[model samples]
Target: MRKALIVGIDYYSHITNLGGCVNDALAVRGVLERNADGTLNFPTPNVLIGTNDTQPVTKTELKSAVRELFVDDSDVALFYFAGHGYLEDTGGYLCTSDSVDGDDGLALSEVMTFANQSSAKNKVIILDSCHGGSAGSNAIARTMTEISDGVTILTASTATQYALETGDGSGVFTRLFVDALNGAAANLVGDITPGSVYAHIDQSLGTWAQRPVFKTNVKKFVSLRKVDPPIALADLQALTTHFPTADHDFLLDPAYEPERSPGQENDPSIPPPDPEKNAIFQVLQKYVRVNLVRPVDAPHMWHAAMGSKSCELTVLGQHYWKLVSEGLI
Candidate 1:
């Protein structure tokens, strides 16, 4: 089972209210609730949004929800917060609606404690507020951070930076985050993990923009979401079959190009395409489309086949070949 607590506080009685945090939370909930195929991903995320005229999200409420979220012995427990952040001599705090000078909402260190001690197999915390990078940092040392095993943290900015809003009811960090969850961070087989999400967001932002922070202590990453694969699974698994070895090249001939078959307009002199070879070529073409295979000494797969040249696995293809050989794919 996977559980998520999504909090977005836009209404604060004692401080300047944000306009985009609620939207960000809702957007996150939308994506987390369903996968690309409309299958359930996480059960409808527990969303807590603070808006005008509503009972604001108090520190107690947020803390209780977070505790409940992590207490379960589930596969994954994810907490996402988008709101005001406070950093002072006391450390970083996720501010609540009633935040004051001495009393911020929940301390970042406290939240990390919940995550560190959680029964869940995997704990993921994503913060999209100012000084969010302080989430994993040491309060006293300020230079070191402690992350427990199976815990991962992805924050919007460094300790001193401010998370930006686009002025259109969307945060700059969250906009990219939503995109990442929607497949921008997906691998060839469509798995999206926290590491990939961070990579996507990190590269998308310019040097002058706020930097995203990632901290983790895990043996393997958990897939946060899945999308349609760029290449079919059967084809991916066939990598080893096609190459025999990673560096091996599969020879091609006119029989591999259906276009060179009899009755085709331009290639009457070429031998008709062999049905068996043509079928194999079709799969090879799929690999070529995704950059797993490339024509040798020819500009295109068609040219390689028609000229009786050869095709070889690309660097990425070799990687997949290794996976296939080891039954890892």
Candidate 2:
């Protein structure tokens, strides 16, 4: 059966400054659950590190967790981490609860070694931490030699910038990463591709000051075997247009819409007597005018629109309405 090991650390005493590691751990789990095929369904991986518990993850705990999670002859193995990452004098160290205590903390090399020791056919390592490298440094270099032929490594940022904490006290990368993973319930089976995960995290954090970087050397076949893309806007628009109230709704409710700015809050863009609902309805109308693709079957529309693997605008169904309503095609 396939197995996954997800760890998030938001409470490292020394690296208490780092954000979202715990939530990141939860998010990674969500990603695996949504991505893993039910035909090959497997038990949840044991979580060894993070803020959900009291004590922090120790080297012994981490090593033990790795050994247990990547048992011999497993079909697939996945490892995810969200925590303080430091490029130390030795190499890259995934700072753990015990890391703050002494030098026994887990090293990137050691983590790689453990994976190499495993019997899994496919392996993926996801790290959302800062890289300790110089300008022009190849963060991929850190794991290239260590990664087996079937292994892939995805990091949160390039070797330069530090991963940031959101105002809510979580890492921006983790927040976006988790949000995307959680969104999978609205997508199709086997639709959670790695490219889609990257897109999810990418768009989720693109506007932020610090964006994460994803690096890989594994052949596309092995690395991307189970990856899927995010739900497309056209798909969401279509769902709303057709069923308008499907159980697995992808559209943001009026309550979830971003509030109007101070300049427009009291005095809405729409004039009086339009009905109070017009405020939100007007915004929704504008969205529908600009975003929906037209004239397609429900399934086809779903695929054409929400099947976006990237952040680009996808056209489906009624391109006519979008143009006329938004004054552009």
Candidate 3:
């Protein structure tokens, strides 16, 4: 089976405050759990994770947890993080909660080394923190350091930019991130592929907050191949490897089908109204209190609310699913 390690830290004793990193991490876990199938190609990911707000997330604990999760026999393994992060100056490092000004911060290379040693064939890293940019504090290391072979790294922004920080809510980068993930899979884009995710979040963030940025590095990696959506357990079984994409062809394939194929399949000319998409949409509607489709015309309170959109629902749903599936919610 595949494996996934999700970590989120919000309440930092000395680390920077992260209001929504842990929430985002857990939400990712939810999507992973619902999507996992125990087939040879598409196996359920065994999840391992820790959140700072819910529980104490220590550096040593995190290191050990990662080692245990990325076993030699694992298949598709994923590593996700949402928390306060910074770029260090001395040796070009990304600092985490445990990081100190001098030498405590975990080096990006160090995390990559652990990931490389894993046995999983396909691996992905998602970071929702900005690389350092403030000139005074040891120039932030923006270099795209290699983490692992055949590993894809998706960041909220490039080394030079900082993720958006609204009044007192999720970082703009991560907020848009969860939305894209939950919403992308069911859209015509097929499953929420990394590239598609980058596109949606980057655009939304740019529109909402000008400086918002998202970036990724694909080193010796092949793009995801789309398969028909899972209908039955048998269908899931047939899909040995299913990583949905936002490609037009995948969405339009005559033979390819999705879980909630509505109007389109039977009506031919019409497209489907994704219920999973609707559920998420509803959650967003309830939380944000505005129709995403009609946000421009909605009340000003929609924009003013701190927890707009089904942010809480999506976040909690993902967290609960990950914990139940991975045995570590």
Instruction: Please tell me which predicted candidate would have the highest TM-score against the true structure.
Output: 1
TM-score of 3: 0.54
Report the C-alpha lDDT of model 2 over 1-329, residue by residue, as the tens digit. Answer: 67878887766656454555676676566555644443333356766555633767866788777777666767667777777776754567777775763345677777777776667777667777776222122245643344566665666776557877677766676666555544432223224445566777776665646655654445552322233423334533443343322222333222322344346445643233334433433433333443532213333322322232111122432343343335331
Tens-digit per-residue lDDT, 1-329, candidate 1: 99999999999988898899999999999998888998999997899999984768989999999999999789999999999998887789999987875246899988999999988999999999999999888878888989899999999999899999988999999999999999999988999999999999999999999999999999999999989998889889988888999999899988888784445655567787799998999999999998899999999999999899999999988888998899888
Global lDDT of each model?
Answer: 0.91, 0.54, 0.48
* Model 3 regions more than 4 Å off: 36-54, 90-98, 132-148, 166-168, 185-189, 207-329
| TM-score: the better of candidates 1 and 2 | 1
In TM-score terms, candidate 1 sits at: 0.95
List the candidates' TM-scores in order: 0.95, 0.57, 0.54
Q: Which parts of model 1 have CA positions greater than 4 angstroms off?
A: 260-269
Tens digit per residue, CA lDDT, model 3, 114-181: 66676667666676666522211222443434444556667766555665555455666666666665
Model 1: ten consecutive residues of lowest lDDT = 260-269
